[model samples]
Target: TTDSGVGSTPAAEAVAQRLRAAGFPEADIQVIGPSARKKNVVARLHGSGKAKPILIFGHLDVVEAPKEDWSPDLDPFKFVERDGYFYGRGTQDMKGAAAIVVTNFIRWKQEGWVPARDLVLALTADEELYGDEDGVDWLLKNHRDLIDAEYSLNSDGGDFQTRDRKPYSIAVAAGEKKETILQLVTHNRGGHGSQPRKDNAIYQLNAALDRIAKLRFPVVLNDVTRAQFDALSALESGQVAADMKAVSRDPPDAAAVERLSEDPYYNALLRTTCVATMLEAGHGPSALPQRAKAVINCRIAPGHTSAEMLQTLRETIADDGVEIAWQFNEPSDPPASPLRPEVFAAVRKATDRMWQGVVLMPGMETGMTDARFLRAAGIPSYGVSGTFLEQGDGRAHGKDERIRVSDFYAGVEFYDRFMKALAGG
Candidate 1:
């Protein structure tokens, strides 16, 4: 709903104002940022100093949505409650979870409750922008003490995935893949449409893209994914379950990998993924292109480096004509957050109370998040929230973004339980 880069400051200020109204001192509730538009709100609920603070945070920004792009019955900017669902840009991607966390923190304060440790809530800005300068990274760099914590739970992490409208898994994102953007370029002399040649620039570019389309990086299981599948194996029954168990082992079953790779989400969890996104070719419709370029975005697995991916691309294309180069805005290559037993235990206690028998999944994010920066700064971050989304109907960053109204309230209640469990109110 809000403009992509220019954060809705009124929203951030409103959150800070709410904390103050709820008896949070002015000193503990702050709206800080580089400018008026791009701001972050951080609030604290004091606790007994029995343990270091734990942060629960999320960004205020959502991906840009144009009104014309949404369905005829919906508006991108406005929040609507209809048919047991709340419709808006950020309802699914985050803001719903943000609201839940803030409510829980305020509830604790009003009840005169004290936790075993401080609970820091950092509602930040500009996370949708890759390599953003004013969000979580900015807070950690410029004002570490305000939001520093022993560990963090990012509301950006999704929870409670459903299959056939049945709740099945509670995913705790313990790790995420770093991203590297690469541009594949092909250049040749311009010519008239009538004078086609085998070494045409456009043709060369297409061939390189075609090769990448069929390429699948070999499966490499990091600790998070390995544990994730191990749990899934017990929860699922059939060939998929066997594959999950097989892939987590030291010598991963190639046949099992092939079977699981049929699903895009599972495939992404198993290895790095590179696919062409943007393309630029001929200057005119009928003209032979003098220069053609295609951009490929790669979500790299935990252990691999961008340099290594670049080499992999070059080797795959196997063509001297293609000049592949790694693009800028490189993401942080931090190690995965160690799967601490305490965090999982807390998550399990809360999840089992709500969605009993649901799988407790310690998964990896195939997509990137600001957690990379936090992980780089030695603040272990996990993506945990009570918001549930349908498996295939996750419309985040897409048209008609919405969340089930019942699920939203359930999330509010779940956060209440989770916060109490983790901090011991």
Candidate 2:
């Protein structure tokens, strides 16, 4: 849900309404948050007291989509079904997955089929804001008992990946890079706009940024990414395939690294990335003489620390003049979730039933997700929703965002099966 009207209250209420209709007591259907406009929905369906509870979750928040930025025929807020596709802002990242989770939960509740363990459904807000005041971490901190489970199944990260609208592989997110930010601030004496100084704050900060831009983190791969390159190596052929195999090994061939780094996606997968996202200069447009600040957002690869990343930035910028500090940083290190065999087996069972010839493998998320928080809390999280998207067409957080209707329903079935298999219903 976007902030255009009320916050995520409507979506949370919708989930609560369905749970209540399915005979869930008001106590079981909780709409909780700091305010009415911002809240999260948490409910549990009981089962036999045989195993640990399972948590299934998706974020209600979607990235903002300015109406003007989208195609003229489409509005980001309205749900439009055309050409076998459903178009909207959060259809893919990921109100759609939340809907599927709720649908399957209510379906099981209505059928009165008890599983081996309880199923917890958490439809939370502010995940797009990195779990703000109303997101998963807030819920975990405020009411951990309500949603505690053995493992969390994040429905945002997809299980099935389709390149060129064809099945490429079933990817389970076993690794996620850490998310952190470093702020650079420069202070200088104020003067008139007509009087320029070489020691100006803006100029000094810009020089440091220029140096930071040219900086590149070293190439490395954790278990998930190494497995990804190994599986994709077979799918690709010729020089690309050879490079994938080459880069998968330690002390990777220098020539292969150079060739693969040419692709932006592969490069991001290969190394930690830090890029300037926000900048603020002098207080007034006419005055650029006082201070300048810049925020460099970094997605550090696994097995690294915020301290290490900070040191890297300091050495790269090599500017003692520009003060650098952290801005609400999370732990830059969370050991990669172990690639459990049972989880992969369940994912493969569902994927094989749907996409025949598709390969199954573990992968890493270069971007951050709520899974990071859960993992840090010692609850290993597996991101294996069945959502499949066409390659080179992921418009999440961009204009004209959409998901194929076929893929959506297919994902619903796949997720339902995947969960049932995991829980042994």
Best by lDDT: 1
* lDDT computed for candidate 1: 0.86
- What's the distance in Å from true for residue 124, model 1? 0.8
Q: Quote the positional error of residue 390 for candidate 2 in Å.
A: 0.9
Best by TM-score: 1
TM-score of candidate 2 relative to the true fold? 0.93
Residue by residue across 229-253, what tens digits does model 2's lDDT show?
A: 8887888899999999998888678
lDDT of 1 by residue, 1-425 (tens): 25544475777898988888889999998899887898899999999876789998998888888899999889878899999899998998888888988888788889898998899999888888867788898898899999999999988984578776667888799889988788889998988998888888988999989999999887868889998889889877999999999999977899999999999989998998999999998899888899999999998888877777778888999999899777754645787899978888888888888776688878898888888889989999899878888887889999999999888888888888888888885
Clash number for candidate 1: 0
C-alpha lDDT of all candidate models, in order: 0.86, 0.84
| lDDT agreement of model 2 with the native | 0.84
- After superposing candidate 2, which stretches have Cα over 4 Å from the reference? 25-27, 190-197, 282-288
